[model samples]
Each structure stands twice: as C-alpha cells, then as structure tokens.
Target: MTVTSAASEPGDRRGAFLLLGAIILVWGINWPVMKVGLGSIPPFWFGGLRLLLGSISLFLVAAFRGRLTLPALADWPVVATVGLVQMAGFLALVNIALLHVPAGRSAVLCYTTPLWVAPGAALFLGETLSRRKLAGLALGLAGLLILFEPGSFDWSNRPLLLGNAFLLGAALLWALTILHIRGHRWHGSALDLAPWQQLTGALPLLAVAFLVEGGPDAIDWKWSTLLVLAYNGPIASGFAYWAAVAVTRRLPALTSSLAFLAVPVMGLTASAVALGEHPQPALLLGFLLILIGLVLVEYKPRKPAA
Candidate 1:
C-alpha cells in the first residue's frame, strides 16, 4: 500500500518545522481537551464523534479547495488499514487508558512511538541510523525514562497497569501507521484521502458505539463539550493530521519520530495549566533533553562524494 502526501517532492524544512510547531501546540493542548470532553461524553462515543466531526471538517476543506476525491482502487486497502489502526484502534485505546491514567502519564507512554518507529523505518524504509539520529534516539529515550518515573508508578495496581498497557498498544499501532504512511507510493495526496480514512475509521467505532455504548445520544451535550469537540475535530485532528502527513513526507522517518517526543512534553505542560496538575522537576529536564534530541535528529551532514 502506498501512502501519498500533498507534495511529491521533499518539503521545505522551514515550513515543515513551522507545521511541527503548530502540530505540537494544538495537539499538545488536546490532552486537556480530550479530558474535558470525556467528562460529558462516554469514551467510545466521544472517540467516534471526534472522528465523525473531523471527517466532516476535512471533507469540507478539501471540497472548498477542489481537492476532494475518492482514493484509487489500489489505495483503498491502505486507507482502510490506516483508518482502522491509526484512527479507530489508537484513539479507542488511548481514550480507555485516559479513563484510568493521568493525562500526563498516558501522553508520556504514547509518545514512546519513536522507539517503535525507528526500527521499522530502518528495516522497511531503509532509512539509515546516522550517528546524530542515534544520539537523538538515545537522548529522547532517556528523557522519556526520566519523565516516566517508573519507580513511582504503581505497577502493582491493576488499573494503572491496564491503562499503561493500553497506552503502549496505542503507541505501537500509531507507529505502524507512521511506517505505512512513510512508505506509501502516492496515488493521491494525504489530504485528498484524509476525510475518507477518517470516515472509514469512524464507521466501525460508530457501529460499536451504537451497539455497545448506545450511540451519540450517550453524549452529555454542554457548551464546553461542544466547544472542545469542535476544536478537536476541525483544528487538532483535521488540520493537524494534514500538516503532519505533509511534513512527514519531507523529513526522515527517524527525525519525525524523534520530534514526536515534543508532543508529550507539551501535553504535560498544558495538562498542568488547564487541569491544575502539578509538574515535577523531571518534566523540565525532559523538555530540555527532547529539544536537544530534535536538534540531533534533524541535523544533516553534507555528502562527501557523489
């Protein structure tokens, strides 16, 4: 299955970095947003509604831009697979984990996506593990370890263990999607299929919600709930997903994976501010390590000979 992005050629680093920053900012805040939504919405229905609204938002934007179209016959399977794993599987897992885990802790575990992506990129995409990238990977993992605070986590507690495992599954599934997207040969730009993939992913969830969770009526409608859902659907999941796909095509897979380390840091920070969760000093140190890791991962050396 071939995944395609908006640009066939490599993208401008400056623009990609700018998109990265925006993705982190919006998605980082989404932790609190999801937490807020879960307050008035059942987890499965909330996840399904988010994808439904997100699909609508993307389709509208693509139509307005005259870029909306169905995926090619050859692309449908890839689209369905990604929709299932990346959207339905990952989100459902994370939502369930969030019910038992703190937003910050869950974010940390999910951001371990890089650990999974790096090896897959090397094996499947044939991306090299450059010295700087290796250093960055090490630094990022170290930072995550510090932030994870394993000694403090109650591994003995069944709920915490289950929540953490759910998050880990989310991370692995997300990594598989990233690897697939990175290797996909283009039949259409990622943006062109965004709505379709989102909708495809939502269908299963919607069915499950109707059968298991009793459908959208299960949602407790409130101003705050509607506001966050709107933000998530249009801005965070819709725009951010497009931007990420475009940027991922431009950057090395390893670099993209390492950069993901920033999201959890931002999520942690936003959760602290919005949810009144106190931050530990390790959080600050983790931020520094991630920045350094990003720098290392992104740095490119000039070729010595042709």
Candidate 2:
C-alpha cells in the first residue's frame, strides 16, 4: 500500500505537469495563430468572437459541473475591469499588432509581465522588492530597449507600437487584477470566477464587434482561421484558464512564475519554425536578459523564523 501510494503521488504530479505543459504549448502557438486569424477578421471582431465562444464553452462546463453562479451585483465593476483589461485591452491590441509586428516579436514583448509585476506587487501589495528582483528588472528593461531600438520607431508602424503598448498595459492591468482577485470578497473557487468574468467582460466587445465588423457576416471564413479561433476560444481560454487557476492553488507564486518561463521561449521558437520568422541577435539577447531577470525575481531565500 505504501509503495502504491508513493507511485500514485508521482503520477498525479506528472499529470499536473503535463496539463501545464499543454497549456503553455497551446498559448505559445496561439501567437502565430492569432496572426493568421487576423488576416480574415478585424482585431476587435476577432477578440469579440473568441471571447464569445470562450464564454459559452466555459458556461457550459460550469453548468455541467453544477458550479455556475452569477456574479453579485457589487462584483460587476470588478468583472468589467477584468474584462476590459484582459479581453479588450490585451487581446484587441495584440490582434492588431500582429499585422505590423512579427508574431514572435510581439509575444516576447507581452510576456514581460513579470518585470511589471515585481514592482506592482511591491507597491500595491506590500510585497518585498528584494535586491535580486530589482537587478532582474534592470536587466529585463535593458533587453526591452535592445528589442525596441530607436531605429525601429516609425509612425507608419503605429499599429505595432500600439500593440506593444497595449500588451504592457495589459500586464500592469493583470497584476492589478491579481491583487483584486486575491483581496475581493468573492464566494467561489477560482474556476467559478472564470466563466462569470469571461461572459461579463465579453459584452462590450460583442457590441463593438457587431457595430464595427458587420456582425458575423464580416468574417471571411476559412478552415485555417476557424481552427485557430476554436483553439484559442475553447482550449486556450476556457480550459487553460481553469487549469492555471487550479495549479496556482497548489504551487507557490514563485514556482508558478518559473514554470511560465517556458511559455515565451516556446512561443518565440514555435513562431520561428512554424511562421518562418527570424529574430535579430539583439532580440535574442533581450530574451536572454528577460529570462535571467525572471529567475532573479522569483528566487526566494529562506528566512529565519521568530
């Protein structure tokens, strides 16, 4: 019985790890997939559709599990904030940015979330900003400078800059969201919050997509585009979001951040192999520094107990 229990523990952990890996793979590939999808639909429309589908799927799952709960009237404001930040602010900008910047380049820029989170956490949550984290932030910012050189600036490329800016803004918003969720008086598992947030947040986007993109008729349908859309909606947004919330409960925040290190690298590598985009040397160096900074930020030293 002892041996069986020990073996089962490892198996369980491995399953969790595999699930996390799958989430990263799907999300990493999603960068290029969004680029492909955007060719056939406008950014707001695509975001609206994806979130609509995701909301439906998540609601169905919640219903099936008997876990669906409507958001309280007071929580509407928080839901709206998350919706605007994650769906409208982040996805809309990223979708449009893909037209101007390579998918790989944009992915690198977006995953700079940890850099922003380190300081935000310190300021908002009273989390300590250790020397190591400060050093990491410096290194990561240096890398960003290399990636976004002065020569790369051009008004004609406004969309790309806008996208990068939106992603950075989204990261800050996400950090705030994290702070909000942790402190808010919600009465459910994180899984329960997922569908409510997606559905609630998608309302404005739905309206905008319909008004701007001529409803569903605007989409120039293609199998490739549809496949990407489905993947992002159901698998990436629906399942992956739940999985991440589940895993974070079992792992420390630092450990979770370490796990996500794989995401940006995989995103860039997959973009190169699948999309035939080549990253510049400076860009490569920038990613290296970002990775190093992430490690520094997440590394924790043991403290003496009172």
Candidate 3:
C-alpha cells in the first residue's frame, strides 16, 4: 500500500516514526491537561470550546496555505458523519468519562479502539485476521478483565463503572470512524477537510452547551484553564489531529493503532507526575497485558529464503 501525504517522503519509515512520536507526546500530555481543564468547566462546553478554537486555528493554517475551500458537495455527507462520530461523539464521551475516571486510566481504556478496528477491518474490508492478531485480541481482553473485574474495580462505585463504559463506547465510535476513513474515497485531501470537520462537529456541541449547560460564560476560566484550552485546541486537536490522520494514512491500520498505544503510556506517566494519580496493581498488570497484545498484533515474521 502506498502512503501519499505531504509530509511523507517515499519509503520513509523514520519520518513516520518521528511524526507518530510527536503525536503520542502531544496527545498523551493532553490527557492530564484535559483533566485540568475539566476541573474549571463542564464536559460538553469544554469539548465545544476546544473544538471551536481548534477549528479556527486550523482554518487559519489552511487559509495561509491557500487550501481553504468548501468541501465538494459529494463529500459533505462523509465529512458530516465523520465530524460527528470522530470529533463530537468521541470527545464528548471521553470528556464525560474523564469526569469520573482518572486521566491515566481513562487513556488506557480509550485506546482500546485498535481491538475493535482490527476485527472490523477483517470483517468489512477483507483485511487478514491472522492467528497472531486473534491472540493479541484475547490478551487485550484479558487485560480489560483484569482492569475491570470486581476484584480490581469496586462495582459499587457507579461513577467509575459508568465512566469506564463510556470510554469503551468512545473507543468503539473511534474505531468506526477509522473504518470510515479507511473506506472513504476522498474527493479532496483529507487534510483539507479536517478543519471543516472539526468546525462542523463543534456546532452541535456548542448548541448543546448553550441549550443544556446554559452558555459559554458558564466556563469559569482560570488562567490555567485558558492555557489548557489553548494547548488542547491549537496543539492537541489542531496540529495533533492533522498529524495523526497523516500518520495513520501512511501506515497500516493495525500498525497505526499499535503506535497509538504510546499515547496512553505517556498519559499514564504524565498523570502520575502532573495529576498525582497513583498507579494500582491491577492497572499495572492490565497495562502490561495490553502492551503485549499490541506487540503481538503488530508483529510480522519474515519468511526464509528457499
């Protein structure tokens, strides 16, 4: 498969890795930053505000590059659907979940998108579902069970349970979005439509915030809160989203997903350092299992010469 991207040089694995590393770092740190932002704002409004800002930032870049134009009419449906599912749905659900779950643990659960994507690709796109990948899936499930079992998480804690469930839902929605992107026959460059999609997704969220949460003034914007929003919007959502999409386009789905696993690991570390979240035994065990599973899924053995 050829990966055609503005940033990609032909046969450039090193460039891809560098891009992936930057994404993991930005996104990983953004987890704790998001938690901090939510401390000062409600979930829906926080998401809306970030998207709105990010969209504007991205539009500026697009316009500067002379690439800002309306999406072709035929592409609007795909853009709208992707905007809703990927930006609005995924962010809203994850933000709600973060209200209950700690940032590190939330990151871990949310990245389980790959487990769904691998199978979905096989079923719908005719990608190979090899035995290694199945084993990896089993291992990842074992990790989830270890993380979520009654022995690990107190079932009596309703918020935690609900939060975890929401994260899982977000992961599934994200997986669906991935499949959609993979299948989309782009009428224009995906990069060109990215800001528009972000803008489109932000509209409903802003509407909901006004209708349900009262209005934009509801946000009690501390300087720290404003700072986090700046980081989340321009760096995380704007640059990071585009970088991620570019990197994913340049790699295989499973490989892209596996590389994304770094986000949670960095999130975990950042949460521990920045948010002072303690790691639990079950979380450690689950993290290890999930890491192993990802490695298995991405591993490709070489054939010997005859």
Candidate 4:
C-alpha cells in the first residue's frame, strides 16, 4: 500500500504562496472599496449583508464539495465564540471605523493583529515568546503608537471617537479569536468552518443592522456599493480567508501571520492610488516599522541536526 502525507509538497507550497499573494492583493484593494461603499450604506448594515452573502456562498460551495461536516457539539460553542469575536466584533468595528477614519488609517489599525497576537499567544496559547518575536512585538507597537497618535486619536467629533474605540475593540476581539482557534480543535478547513460561523454570527448582525439602519428600504443602491459588496463578500471573505487557512496549514503560524503585514501596506498604497489619499511621512515610517517587525517575527533560526 502506498502512503500519503498530509504535508504539502514543493509544488503545493508554491501554489499556496501564489494564492496567499492573490488574497493579499484582493484584500488590499478592498479597503478603499469598503470606504467608498460605506459612504452610501450604514456600516452595520453593510457588514451584516456582506457577511450574509458570504455565508450563503461558502455554505453552498461546502455542500457541493461533499466536505461539509458538522462540528461536534463541544466544538460548536468555540466556533460560535470565535465567530462572534472575529467575524461580528471585528467586522462591525472596522466598518464603523471606516466612517470616521480614512480607509488606510483604519486598515493599519486593524491589521495590528500581530501586536496583540504575540502577547496572547505567549500568555494563553503557551507558545514560547522568543527574543525575535518580542523584539518584533515592540517594533510593531512602536509603529502603531506613531500611527495612533494625533492621527487616529484626533477624534474631533463624537462619532469619530466611538469609531476609533470600536476599531480597537474589534482588533482585541480578533486577536482573542485567533488565540482561541489555534488552541482548540476545529475539525475542518477554514472553508468548512467559516460558513457555519458566519451564518450563525450573522443572525445577531442582521438584527443590529435592521435596528440601526431601519431595514432594506433605507438602503440606496449604487454601482459602487454593489461592487463593494461583491468584492468584500465573495472575493475577500470567501476566497481570501480560505487561502489564509490553506497557507497556515502549510507554513508555520508565525510565518503565515507575518504575511498579513503586507495587507496594511498594500491597503495604504491602494487607497492613495484609488482614492487619492496622500500618504503622510509618519504613516510611511509606521509602515516601515511594521514591515521590520514582521520580518523579525518570521525569522527562523536553523537547527543543526545531531
């Protein structure tokens, strides 16, 4: 009998990298699209509807592929927990933040997931905090502080302050979700679990959206809005999230997480190009620090075999 390995082959690694790159690119461009779309749609409404569409699409795909399996009852609670923290909490906050902050600024803040993850992993996940990771965490926080001061904190208005707080809450929840998922036993690919989580979590969001936005009748249709929904729902959530899970299975968690550093940088650049937002020098510096931190976090020391 021939034996098969679960580890990805060299060819598979290359494909994973390509898929990861595409995910980053699509998500990068999506930042500006979301900002533009939120101009017309309420933030909660937009997030709820987008997630609803993504859940339906992903569930249909999972059903068709015959790979769908229900999580054990024990697993369902964790799944729901993660869904609320990562999907609902994070998405709603970011969506709301977009209304107050520039897309690029909001993207940078949200992508600070790594900063939170390092500590969370160390404390909760029992992952050893290496010197490199600690340094990287410091560097990332420094960068974030630079970005956060004056710019992110300048909430001259009440909505802006609420938005900023919401974004921070989202980031914290997302970091917690990541830690939980990594520590727990989830029996399928992100493709498999994502649909269930989204479908279930979306129920609350749908209610909130209706309560806040006052129903579908209040939504105005625009071509840009439709484009945002399609991109964020199908391409970004469906495809990008799946690609991330696939890559994480192949690469070390730290390595895959480091790749996320590209998301904010790409988002910032895309915003400048697409939305005509000018880059500030401090923001550029912050981006540099973030990149440096990512590099440090992913740096692996070679082990000599005995």
Q: Tell me the number of clashing residue pairs for each predicted model.
A: 3, 0, 0, 0
lDDT of each: 0.78, 0.74, 0.83, 0.76
Better lDDT candidate (3, 4): 3
TM-score: which candidate is best?
3
Q: What's the true lDDT of residue 86 in model 1?
A: 85
Ranking by TM-score: 3, 4, 2, 1
Stretches of model 2 off by over 4 angstroms after superposition: 1-11, 73-77, 151-156, 304-306
Q: What is the TM-score of each candidate against the true structure?
A: 0.83, 0.89, 0.90, 0.90
Worst 10 residues of 3 by lDDT: 1-10
As for lDDT, the candidate ahead, 1 or 3, is 3
> In model 4, which runs have C-alpha deviations exceeding 4 angstroms?
1-11, 151-156, 252-254
Query: Which window of 10 residues has the lowest lDDT sum in candidate 2?
Result: 1-10
Q: What is the alpha-carbon lDDT of model 2 when measured against the actual structure?
A: 0.74
Candidate 3 Cα RMSD after full superposition onto the native fold (Å): 3.1
lDDT per residue for candidate 4 within 213-243, as digits (tens), equals 8988767787877878888787787777667
Ranking of predictions according to lDDT: 3, 1, 4, 2
